[model samples]
Target: MPVRSPSLVELNAFLAVARAGSFRQAAQELHVTQAAVSRAVLRLEQELGQAVLARSAGGVSLTPAGTQLRQLVEKPVAALQAAAVRMRKTPERLRLRLSVVTSLGALWLMPRLEAFHLLHPEVEIEFRQYHHDEDFTRDDIDLWIAIKRSAPQRWPRHIAAQYLIGREVVAVCTHERARTAQTAPLLLAQPLLYHSNFPDNWALWAQAQGAKLPLQRKGAGFDLVMNLIEAARSGMGVAIVQQCLAEADLASGRLVIPVPGSASTGRGYFLCRRRAQDAHPAAELFAQWLMQQAGAPPTV
Candidate 1:
């Protein structure tokens, strides 16, 4: 026998009867006559070749087939109803989805998000975090903030990339460690913290100071900047991190820059978007605001 598809109306009628256990009650809930609800379910049974409901003097009860069908369609039907309601409510509101690095999202973006919200209460923001080398093309992301050695070259042809902010790498430690009599050599002897994504940060800083780091230096490694910064603040190790991420910790006296100066990594943060699609108005505004906050001039 051929598998017949039941209409959404029929499925809805069946579900109502199954939930209420009475065709009359289901009809009342659906704003239809009891006979109409019964006819819809009968038509559904004919298509499926199974008697789904067992009518009783008290009320209708589900047969075995009806129980299985109800279990499968219940949640999906509810989800569809919910989606319809949401569509009716905010069909025009702009939903801007962004992908950002974990550390940047936690330390920098989250703090400044309130300002964006206050400026555009109508816009909704969704955040997605991507770690090292994760593919962004399939993510359906509206915008991306990425740290790169230079402008990205491997992005899809439709993607537009713009330089956001250049980062300065600095070595930081807990306030207690900063208070100790520490020299560059002494600091190198201490356990150094490293980011898994940027493992050579300490070496890069050492190179900027015209010194070669020892091959056997002790250190702890973390996959995220926030974790590395926290580890440093907890006195676990000395952390080499971007100046932007440590600014708050430094200002609050939780962490201090043990090193005197920063190293230029020839790298920077970039804002990326798909060029073929019209930019979401909210995303454009947020991008401009981000540039303003980073003190970078808007690109033409």
Candidate 2:
């Protein structure tokens, strides 16, 4: 007889634990009891005939087998779940497909989505996150909340755009680093942190302010905004990033803006869609809700 594969539930539980690195945290994330999560992992281990995870006081670490399995299954599992959801939705349900760059999606949108879900329980929203760029050609997406330059004249004529918020770049570092307001001299004294996708951010901000920042750069660049933020919080260096993405930390006193005046780098966020596609009702509702949340005018 062929070997029986682990069930999806078991794989999901295992993946969740691997992600969280603790059964308790994974259980909380999955909205299940800790005992249930433990049982699922146990069942998976029994099926595999070996230990996949190493448990200890420091928390769980994946074994060699677990690491291999996680690499193979993570994307496939998420895709399977997404496909299943599409198949399971009823005709009566209103669904909206939306895309956005990863930084804005994680830092800004995800935290505020609960309110939208509360207000419009009947509308189902699907979020597709892109790491580097916005993809407007995907036929299934109803709308895209994208980060783009403020110049509407440059936008594709075939796309309809709504203004959201301008991107204000701020230089942030720990209190230990910046005893006073940020200046070009003070900023250049420390490492200049940047995001890989927007490598020109520091240059843009400097030019916007006419600060004459160095043409050649030094310091680290992170592909993910979260990593850059954490690096700033850890006092790795002064990081230039969008203000909206770092507001939570600034409010909590985890990070402080050293820049005397945040500079707009001639870019902003816009809600966009292809001109040819008919808008979904759910997309309309989401767009309205998002505009209100963003305090932006409804039209471009």
What's the TM-score of every candidate structure? 0.62, 0.62
Cα error, candidate 1, residue 98 (Å): 1.4
Judged by whole-model lDDT over C-alpha atoms, candidate 1 comes out at: 0.76
Which candidate comes out best when scored by lDDT? 2
Give the runs in model 1 whose Cα sits over 4 Å from its true position. 1-92, 129-132, 149-154, 296-300
Model 2 regions lying over 4 Å from their true place: 1-92, 129-135, 149-153, 180-182, 215-217, 296-300
Clash count list over all predictions = 0, 0
Show pairs that collide, candidate 2.
none
lDDT for residue 87 in candidate 1, whole number 0-100: 55
Q: Against the hidden true structure, what lDDT does model 2 obtain?
A: 0.77
RMSD of candidates 1 onward, in order: 20.2, 17.8
